[model samples]
Target: VRTVVDLGGVTFMDSSGLGAIIATYRSAQDSNGWIRIAAPTEPVLRVMQIIGLDTIIDCYPSSEQALNAAEQ
Candidate 1:
């Protein structure tokens, strides 16, 4: 269940959204899978960085990079 979440169009994100991603991450982990975030808007990326979510999940500058990494 490798996942690449494309956030290019997402301009905003709050705790709830973050929580959902966390939950999904946990679920993926439980299944020996992984999740990655890609192309998050600056503000959203800042929020993630402030919360240290960037350390928990890999982030990429583009969805193609994320998906490509998943393949590897």
Candidate 2:
């Protein structure tokens, strides 16, 4: 199983979003699933990078890429 998160058009994110993503990732890992983020805006990407999520989550240049990666 796989989950793709879309961050496009998201100009800002708070701890809630971060926590949600973290929880989702953990859940996926527990279930032997993969998770990815797609097309995050610059600001969102920066936040993810700063929080070390960029290294943890599979990030793609576009949603299609993410979806394809997940499918694979």
Candidate 3:
């Protein structure tokens, strides 16, 4: 399964939130699935970048793009 997390509606997130995303990412990896972020808010983007997840995980401006990437 390919999961697209739409961050467009997310206004805020903290360390715990980041942890959850990482955990979910691992779960997907283990299950041979995938997860992607879509349209992350500026604050969330900063945190993701700081954690270096931006380099490992695919982030797209829209869910459509993420899903397309997943297919490839």
Candidate 4:
């Protein structure tokens, strides 16, 4: 199975959102699955970068890219 978090429409994100993503990531990892983050808005992207999530997370440039990754 695969999981994808589409962030294209999101305008902003706080620590709560970050927390939820991290929790979901952990859950997916534990279950032998993974999540791909897609199309984060500039604001959200900045936050992810600031917190170093960008490096560790599988963040895609677009939703299609993320989906393709899941298929592979």
Q: In candidate 1, what are the lDDT values of residues 1-72, reduced to their tens digit?
A: 678889999999989999999999999999999999999999999999999999999999999999899889
Cα misplacement distance, residue 46 of candidate 3 (Å): 0.7
* Model 1 TM: 0.95
User: Over the stretch 41-60, how does candidate 2's per-residue lDDT look in tens digits?
Assistant: 99999999999999999899
lDDT of 3: 0.88
Better-scoring candidate (TM-score), 3 or 4: 4
Segments of candidate 2 deviating more than 4 angstroms: none
lDDT of 1 at 7: 94
Model 1: how far is 66 from its true place, Å? 0.3
lDDT of 4 by residue, 1-72 (tens): 367899999999999999999998889888988888999999999999999998878899898999898888
Q: Best candidate, lDDT-wise?
A: 1
Q: Which candidate number maximizes TM-score? A: 1
* Candidate 3, position 7, lDDT: 94
Candidate order (TM-score): 1, 2, 4, 3
Q: How much does candidate 4 score in TM-score?
A: 0.91
lDDT of 2 at 14: 87
